[model samples]
Target: MGALEPNAALERLYRETGWTMRQLAQEINRVGTERGTPLKYQQPSVTQWLNGQLPKESARPVILEAFARRLLRPITHSEAGFPAPRRGSTPQPPTLDGLVDLGRQDMDPSRRGVLGVGLFSVALTIPGWPDAVGRMDAMRTDPKRRVGQAEIQSVKDMTDRLSDLDDDFGGRYARPMAAAFLVNTVAPYLKATASSETRKSMISAASLLCYLTGWMAVDEGAHGRAQEYYVKSLELAGASGDRMTYCHVLRGMSVQAANLGHGAPAVRLANAAAEASPDSGARMRAFMAGQQAHAYALAGEKTNALNSLREAERAVNQAESQGRRFGGFSSATLAYATAEVRHALGDPKGSVESLHDHFRLRDSTDRQRSKLIFSSLLAERQLQIGHLEAACTTWNTILDEYPAIHSGRIDGQVRRIPSLLSPYRSNPLARQIYERSRELSAK
Candidate 1:
């Protein structure tokens, strides 16, 4: 039989039940409550219904229940307009084999790049961000040796390389490198490793790498790829049973969602991260709170955003009280996070302040030149908020630093300056910066 058309069924049901869109939504929510499945039917749901789009997976069951209740009969999937389940077909295995291959390649020493230098710099500057040896110690002390020193080293090396790529080339080059490392170096170990320590190490490394990859992907404007990497990282963290890592990955996911303009999911992911691991270290908890605040700001929930920001501050204070030094968190990391939240909240002054703070923390070493690509991003944001002089200054500084770095990633970011400063292209400072960027691009 031809499948029942959802649009036709929806029209008929609405007419027969004398239910307007609002009434139908209320009924669905009521049915969901009665059936122990709380439905969140937002305006988008109504729009989708009007456009004949199917409800999402989470809402499907609740929607079916509402239909059954309204019709005074129990409805099977077919009756509710769902397609029949295919029979006698084995389920396909997950297509993570490519990722496994890439993870292995990431482990190869030849693949390490200048970005590794930035990662090492961050580790040196940030106290809590562990190196291979530190991560190894953490794993060895664990009752399970699921994570090995070799694995830890591999992960560290990959993360460092990714950071370098980000610093040198922008995310365009960093993403492919990160994805390769995750698939080749990490996936195979994940698939075959049995020890708890090994698993934990693998999970931590994979989560961190995936997070980095997702960030790069976001920078490159590949939203779907970024989301996938974040989800994969979250899954890896869960498998390793590391709540802290899970929380971190969740926060990363929230950032991606927020960037993609999915504010609701962003808020949910951030809140879940904050709630799930309240006992985590103050730094970690603060990170989650900060993420939540950013999400709220993006959602235009000004009051909630401010509340979460305050909560983040409180967490930071608690972390400081716990004698947590600011090693694992770099001035750049903190500044970037703060700037992002401030920008979301439409506080340009605050954003600029945070960016300045980040700039203050940057290292003078050649190793850090690649990671300095973030300076360009900060300048771009400054331009957006009408801080033309500040942006011009930052852009000049970035261009000066770019020639010393051999990273394709940094080059890409520098190349973007011309376009970003196009509106002010006629301004002397802006013109100078753009010309310099153009010179670099020409190379």
Candidate 2:
């Protein structure tokens, strides 16, 4: 073979990023770690790639993602000097059929491990509300089966029950069951014959369930998988002319991005959600603004972040005066959002205070999963502020309920408890927490 040619396309993009080869490699490694795969690529690896070396197939996505996050835009194979993927380019399936396929994969035991490793991409292409609205083609109805209002209500009721289960236990225990329901029940309903109004209502109901499934996936840390479900939810919501659900899914996507530390994408998605619903009710407005505030804080836009927080607070107060409640968005939720914003803005003390307010505001109806998560956050911040004993006390409360929950995110928090208290292991409380963490982790 002739000598390899220089990759001019990659070289140009590399220059645009203004990153040293080592920095580029480090970013790639970081992305790998986020995807549950630790990589040790060094400057030499990046040097080879710029000099015409092809990255391993698995590394290609990681490399593209690193550049995408830095450039704040999608980076395609051609744009990055990489060849098209060798896999066959199949046409996209119809909406309902695609949902079935996605749900089946999610439910299958063998494919789940593979799904967990799918990388969350900051450069994912999100369809605008106008573009997605009425985008689905006419479905080939299953004339043998018909659905109506009663069926639609059943779907909604089932989704609510599954959501409750997910809250009381955790996504690890609830997601597969949700996926199974989506595949076995919801998919068939989408294809069943019905009047246009009934069909649209059913689609709207299905979209909400899809969103719930995606939220569960996020709790499990299957972020890329969650994005897939979120996109499908958006499409279904749009096809049904359910604008609110579409915006809700977008905000969930933003939450996933924020959790993954992809601040730019998070902010972009949060803004998109708010823009999509101009005349949203006060309660709905608060829901969107709180997430937007979290996103802006993560993006390091202090002014925009503070502005959104104030808007959320005002909206919440307005909503209360009007006696309107929108799902789980309330003062407690705002306090949690405030804590996230403060934490991101380097105000650990303020964040801790907000968290205290959150717990004080929370009632029995709050999701157990969230209680554990926020409590974990409170403990960590307490530890950060030189309140070791207080942190241990908070952690003890978490441990009392930790083994009962099975969320990947919460599991991660528990896994860290031992190390977090290791430095102060000589202290009785710290040692007790550390020992208990090891004991639970072993199980």
Candidate 3:
């Protein structure tokens, strides 16, 4: 059969009823389950419907039932623009046009609930379209400009707040907040008429915002977008002559690479960070070294990992000797980075030690959240080394604090706990921890 015509009847019903793709899918799934004809539909399937694709024989009845529920009016197969059932056909992936159509229908200003649902549903599945890297490279070749003290201070304040938000709530909320700041605060200043000095500072600030946005994208599993943002940020940092910001961006790139199993590239990026900021304060040196150690560990270079870890320790010590007045790094941040390296190197005891140090230095507001993450990490490491009871105990602690911490990072850590405890799933303690985590997530 030729491609089915756009289903104007279904489209009008969906629009008049103010139904989101997700809500429609959920209602379909619910009805199917109740009638003993269970159906499985992912977000992508809803996307297909919104695109006007005729549902296959198997999906048609359920879609009709779902729209009936949504519109509170009976819908028949003929009314939904379907012919008699025919079986056996391959399914196509949802298209961007389909998603956009659904978004337009659900984003109507007159429907409050539908609008909220549409925004979240669409945001969750938004594709990361890559930008041309050559543009950034061209900008980098442009003449460098000087930046002023006033703009520098403003950038500093914004960066500090962004960092605090990341640490507090992880990357979920941080991404949108950073994006707003970039569009509203940094981007305007970068394009504004200013002296050479002000322009340079504005560029520096904009580059940092780009880096932050990229880091947030990585956290949300949008690696392609993250890479694009990182490249752009690196180009901007080069033009601004901000070696410190360059180091931060490189460090971020290393983390992304390591997470994606590109260990060698991660190690190279970490080394570049250290080399670019050799004269930076002790804390900065330690942070770079800590990243290097983690990268080496991921690359299976045990000796290099150990050496880098020791170097990081030394850098932290030197930073402490500088009267605890390091400009960029704090004791707590250094300790957290050190703990991550130790955890990567299979040193559970050392990881816990460093984590304890981090706790001691962390501000009161961060204690509950950081502790939840550190505890989860500790539990995973324990399970790796066959410390079942210890792992269970740590996991229990994480579960207890999880309700108060809504960080995406912490949620990831929690999700990993079940697999780590798979061997002990039959054990009462392990099952208890797992059940509690499930319950917390349900809430």
Error in Å for residue 73 of model 1: 55
Structural RMSD, model 2: 15.2
Best by TM-score: 2
Give Cα-based local distance difference scores for all models.
0.61, 0.87, 0.63
Q: Which stretches of candidate 2 lie over 4 Å from their true place?
A: 1-93, 109-111
Model 2 — which ten-residue stretch has the worst lDDT?
85-94
lDDT of 2 at 237: 92
On lDDT, the candidate that comes out on top is: 2
TM-score, candidate 2, is 0.78
Question: Candidate 1 at residue 381, lDDT?
Answer: 80
The TM-score obtained by model 1 is 0.58
Runs of candidate 1 exceeding 4 Å displacement: 1-98, 101-185, 191-208, 260-262, 328-336, 361-374, 381-387, 403-416, 419-426
In model 3, which regions exceed 4 Å deviation? 1-155, 278-281, 327-370, 404-406
Tens-place lDDT per residue, model 1, 324-370, is 67444444455666777788877878887887887676565324543
- Give the alpha carbon lDDT tens digit for every residue of 348-429 in model 3: 7787778778768876555455567677776776777677888888788777767665465677787776666666779999
